[model samples]
Target: MSDWLDEIHWNSDGLVPAIAQDPTSGRILMMAWMNRESLALTAAEGRAVYWSRSRNRLWRKGEESGHVQRVIELRLDCDADVVVLQVEQLGGIACHTGRESCFYRVLRDGQWATVDPVIKDPQAIYAGGHGHD
Candidate 1:
């Protein structure tokens, strides 16, 4: 039943790195992991669903913060070990840090610096300690 998933070269831990990107801007938002169930659910739901390694369960994007990603397309890398999800990020937020994307830091002077301003306060986005896994 999961023949499509079997084609993916999952790591020894049974996980594949999944990247979420903005379809319009072609910007990489964040990187995550997906298991067979999550990957299948994402395809069936037309949304991004990731396997939360920290929580050891399925994590649906925007479930905690209302920044759900509507998947536009799903692509597999040449190695078949990585997945790229082209999506329209709802509410324009994809990071738990209240940033548009998780990759808001830039390497400068051999140091990491935040280049983007927080669109909203993370405290307001997440009601409790559920901000990060």
Candidate 2:
């Protein structure tokens, strides 16, 4: 297992991009970064863990909003530089902006368009505060 872990191609920043998708629905939830430690934790715990570049720390999905992702499988790309996490999403919405996915907006005809409606209100979900105590 260690040898396989070592084979992952982490970037210079010691991070890899991880894309999360719904296992049952086949919907892409979001994309995040992961370090070696985060990847290990996710594998061991059956949960999705990510390294937040903005916060400069490890973050467990749904830590705040109870929107946690339960990992079903982890896939490494051919280059081993990218990871795809098949997960069972607890919450319906995945985007911080209350959309089902982060890719709610799309650029069409050289203009940005709202491709989908907001599934939930982020403010309302986080209003009671995150799950972390």
Candidate 3:
């Protein structure tokens, strides 16, 4: 297992893409970047942790929204370039836009379309809160 960890092909940015999926439903929830620390934290804590490139810090998924993802399984591709996390999502909506998944937009014939409606209001979920901000 340690050898597998060492074999992960992190790029020059020292980051790799991690895909989060719903374990029960087999639905892909979201995709985020993970550095080595984030990967270690996620594996140790059994929760999804990601490296926030914009903020230049580690972020726990759903920390602000109360939509934490509990990881059930972590998988690496044959090439060890990408990781897939099977998780049990705590919140119904995994997306900041109030959708179940971040992939709310679908590309159709050279256009992007919003296929899924917002499941819940983000403001309502994080009312008077400071997590996302």
Q: Give the number of the best model, judged by TM-score.
A: 1
lDDT of each: 0.92, 0.86, 0.88
The lDDT leader among the candidates is: 1
Q: Candidate 3's residue-wise lDDT over 1-133, tens digit each?
A: 4655688999899999999998888888889999999999999999999999989999999878888989899999988999999998886778877789988889999999999999888788778754342
Candidate 2 backbone collisions, by pair: none
Q: Model 2, 1-133: lDDT tens per residue?
A: 4667799999999999999998887888899999999999999999999998878899998888778889999999999999999998887777877777887878999999999897776667788754220
Better of 2 and 3 by lDDT: 3
TM-scores vs. true structure, each candidate: 0.95, 0.91, 0.90
Tell me the deviation in Å of residue 12 in model 3.
0.5
Query: For residues 1-133, what per-residue lDDT tens digits would candidate 1 score against the true structure?
Result: 7588889999999999999999888889999999999999999999999999888999999998888999999999999999999999999988899988899999999999999999989989888767652
lDDT of 1 at 113: 97
Query: Can you tell me which runs of candidate 1 are displaced by over 4 Å?
Result: none
Clashing pairs in 3: none
Off by over 4 Å in 3: 1-3, 128-133
